[model samples]
Target: MKLVPLTDRVVLKQCEAEETTKSGIILASAAQEKPQEALVIAVGPGGVVDGKEVTMQVKEGQKVIYSKYAGTEVKLEGEEYIIVRQNDILAVVE
Candidate 1:
């Protein structure tokens, strides 16, 4: 099954957490912090939502940064994804 977001919602696949520190120290799994960066999987059509005229600025396949505590986690066909409102996306990575 495919995921289709609705109403300004965005679907993202989070980037993997770093296993080692920049100083070359390997960290345990429990110490790894989830990365805020992700690749855009799917995007919802932007329109009137909650009386606001919203337009989608991001597109599929773009890498983005989002709020630390945003979106809902979902598992589909053994793959994981996060769904969040467009506003939750902070910036798109070049």
Candidate 2:
């Protein structure tokens, strides 16, 4: 299944969190924090929302940083993804 965002929403795939530290010490899964970075899987078409004209700045394949608690999580085919509004995306990673 694929996600097709409506309005100014964006579909993102969470990037894998680091399993090891800089010192090469492996961390337990329970100790790992949910990563705030993700790859843009799909983008919504720009349109008027909330009485404001919104344009999508992120594109598919771009890595982005979003709010820690932003977006709704969904599981499809055993893979996880997030759906957040365009404004929730903080920055686009170069």
The TM-score leader among the candidates is 2
Q: Against the true structure, whose lDDT is highest? A: 1
Clash pairs (backbone) in predicted model 1: none
Q: Per-candidate TM vs. native?
A: 0.89, 0.90
Off by over 4 Å in 1: 26-30
Q: Give lDDT per model, in order.
A: 0.93, 0.91
Question: Model 2 — which ten-residue stretch has the worst lDDT?
Answer: 26-35
